[model samples]
Target: MKPGALALVTGANRGIGLETARQLAQRGAVVLLGSRDAVRGEAAARSLDPDGARILPVALDVTDTRSVAALAKRLERDHGRLDVLVNNAGVFVGATAADTTAEVTRDILAVNVVGAVAVMHAMLPLLRRSSAPRVVNVSSTTASFGLTSSGADLAGDASVRLAYTASKAALNMLTVQYDRAFRQDPDLAHIKINSASPGWTATGMNGFRAPRTVREGARAVVTLATLPDEGPSGGFFDEHGQLVW
Candidate 1:
């Protein structure tokens, strides 16, 4: 996405999402700062852009189909096109495999996987209208089957949560699928979709125990979100470069 591009970031009220929105705004993209709570969203938007020119608050609950549709309709009516979409809304439910329940797993998938796809489906039309569109799915190192299955003690001990890891793994798959769809569709070939890992960041999602700062974590998102026309898609990456999926 270029300067002045239109962008929307879900779960932008805080953490990596908030930092990503701020960075996008600094690059001159008009960003819709999405949060489940409208008040908190507005507060976040203000913090990103005090003049209310670059960052705008939006009430978006990815798990709510109606809310997702409503926002898409509003964006279509106002902007008519979306240049960037950052699916950053996710939940962390730390429970070991033995402690994980069906309900908990289902709930995690609903938001982390289904919700991101829902938003993408709703915004496809608007995205198609743009000459160049980018979609970034926020993922995690815990989602990497290579790392986890290999007994790599990466990310952290909190990553043992089956529900959270599984959700992100599914999300990474969805990102690849979406990228494939765009490549196969002639009219949508310009659209790029990639999964980005923020690494372990110190945020509420992890009790702020992680070592990375929000800015450090958001680099991957911003990089892929603003990729040039030649940038790669359907790959998992972080600030460092390509990552194991």
Candidate 2:
């Protein structure tokens, strides 16, 4: 994104989301650090930007339509436009296939998929105002059928956490679908949207047991969030490059 560009990252109170917000602000963008808890969000923003210059904290609960709309209205009032939107808010709960219930799947999907969609819709107006808008939906490689079927390392993860994996797969599909929809509208045709799998990262989600650091995990996400006009849309990517799955 251009310098001083406005960016919003959900779930920015901790983990990869916070790292992404920091990286974006470091690159000279004005970032909104979103958190469900206002107090945590404020603390995070203060920690990142003590002067309260670029990094601003906001209350945003993607699952709550009222909360999403309120945040969107505030953004429109304060920033006028948004150049980058990182849908990094997500939830993970481990459960075996047989152990997963419909309620569990629904709950996971509610945040990982539905909530992200809600945020996108709320931010569409602000995004449409940008000359080059970009949206990155933070996803996971475990969502890949190709990886699982080909006996890749994430194969086991894909089979075990049925709800989490399935929700991410659905989120990836949303990226493609949203990109296609944008193409039909001249105002949004230039908008870039993609799924960024941060890969395995040491975050609170896994009790920090994962090998990757938050900085490493946020790399791919920031890449997509700041994609150039010529960058590919509707693609799944990691830090290296475009992912086949």
* TM-score: model 2 vs. ground truth: 0.97
Give the best candidate by lDDT: 1
Report the Cα lDDT for candidate 1: 0.92
Which portions of model 2 show Cα errors greater than 4 Å?
Answer: 155-159
lDDT tens readout by residue for model 1, 1-245: 67889999999999999999999998989999999999999988887788899999999999999999999999999999999999999998888778898998888899999999899999999999998899999999888999887888786785357789888999999988988888899989999999999999999988999999999999999999999999999999989999888
Candidate 2 residue lDDT tens string, 1-245: 79999999999999999999999999999999999999999999999999989999999999999999999999899889999999999999888888899899889999999999999999999999999899999999888878867877762355458889889989999999999999999988988999999889999988888889999999999999988778999999999998866
How much is 5 displaced in model 2, in angstroms?
0.3
Model 1 steric clash pairs: none
RMSD of model 1, in Å? 1.0
Worst 10 contiguous positions by lDDT, candidate 2: 151-160
Each prediction's Cα lDDT score? 0.92, 0.92
